[model samples]
Target: MRHIILFFIWLGIGQISYAQEVRYETVENISYVDETASAYAKEQCKLDIHYPTSGENNPVVIWFHGGGLTGGKKEIPDFLKEKGLVVVGVGYRFSPNVKVEDIIHDAAKATSFVMKNARKYRGDVDNIFISGHSAGGYLALMITLNKTYLEAEGLDADELAGIIPFSAQTITHFTARKEQGIDEKQPTIDELAPLFWVRKDAPPIILFTGDRELELLGRYEENAYLKRMLSIVGHEKHKLVEFQGYDHGMVYPGLPILVKEINRLVKEKE
Candidate 1:
């Protein structure tokens, strides 16, 4: 069934009141790549983590920021704080400086690092989720759907607990198309598109998009198609949510939905 939700009402469903105070910590600029990697890789492929200081086995969320693949930095959203979860913000090499494949590999490497070291920060390795906004959302989908990237890191894409992308491009990212001398307005779906690699056995996916009329050109439609295709392939654990009255900058309202999905997935896993 198609699930179209109003952001305001859904936001209230996952609201949790903590009886005890929770403490959080932030560690910045930890390199995810090895020393033997290129200087640019060492500099660009770094991650920042915000985690609870006193909780054991807290769920982990790795966030990628939106900048259309050419810009933007890693950030731990303020909304995700003090929620008894570990949030990792990742930074990767931008295009023109590196190929989109390299950027995706960087994401995989960061995920591998978090999986290996989550225990050091009081996080559960098995309860890891990946998410991002816009271009960052695209990156999250790429690494999760295309197993080769994570496989190169000695990890499996299925290792993730869930995938939640906010207004991500389901087709070839416009930026990747631009690199190939294609117009941004022209939609293409090839290896770089998340739609190109749909399967029934990947992690549970929750796709969030802004209002259909207000989003970036065909953004909501692309995600809708992705949802349809996933169902056609017999994927049962997925949902597509469109926020009414919000545009492409819908990350704010979407954050609450993200938290709700994470909590729900964690509960289901238990």
Candidate 2:
């Protein structure tokens, strides 16, 4: 009976360790992604890596939060924790600390860091998905269309597995144009805008937006136009889903659908 007791104790330990499957890695004070920042004093950023313990080559998602790029933590929504996938919630410097362009640069660097080290976590380097809410969605779209940022990190944007945004602005983000003294009412889509990056070769894009009438600031219409433009460019792997009853503020309640879409998109790519 003593041997039996010890066996059960060992089994319990194994179960406990298994339950801690979502491993985490943090990069504190990430002032810069370049070698120079390693020796400079600057604000830090971190990544909370969550993963399922049982998959051989799991898909990884980098989720950017939305607080108008002024505030928001590097957080994975609680619902995201048990999805049987890998999730990395990002934190970047806000608007006043840096220009809107700098925020895009930070996102690119964070993605590069993850791709460069993907093997360490049993994640597929090719299956990285960029996703976010509101301002975060706008950031995700910019990264997908304006490939320069990822190119700086030596990764091609076309090589990304998918582009998914929840209620992301498709027109010029007001915050960015505001930085240039441009009027938000007279918004323009320039090279910095995601709509400007539409091409036939873009990764499979699955866009989700809230109901048109209930959305904030013409969010649904912008996505509709973006979808049309991508279609005009002959992008066949694109989809736009309008959640019938959901509104701009429903991303928390709407992410599972995004996750399912992620699953579908990756499977198609595979």
Off by over 4 Å in 1: 1-21
What local distance difference test score does each model get? 0.92, 0.80
Each model's TM-score? Answer: 0.92, 0.85
Please report the TM-score between candidate 1 and the true structure: 0.92
lDDT for residue 121 in candidate 2, whole number 0-100: 69
User: Which lDDT tens digits does candidate 1 get at residues 1-270?
Assistant: 234465655655545334334667899999988879998888888999998878699999999998988989889999998888999999989988988878888888999999999999999999999999999889899999899999998999999999999999999999889889999999999999999999999999999999999999999999999999999999889999999999999999999889989999999988
lDDT score of residue 259 within candidate 1: 92
lDDT of 2 at 170: 80
Report the error of model 1 at residue 12, Å: 25
lDDT per residue as tens, model 2, 1-270: 999999999999999998786654433333335556532113445566776556657888888888887888777777777676678787777877778888888888888877777667667888888888988888888888888889988989887889888899788788888887898777688866788887888888888888888998788988999999999989988888888888898786678887888789778776
Estimate candidate 2's alpha-carbon lDDT, on a 0 to 1 scale.
0.80
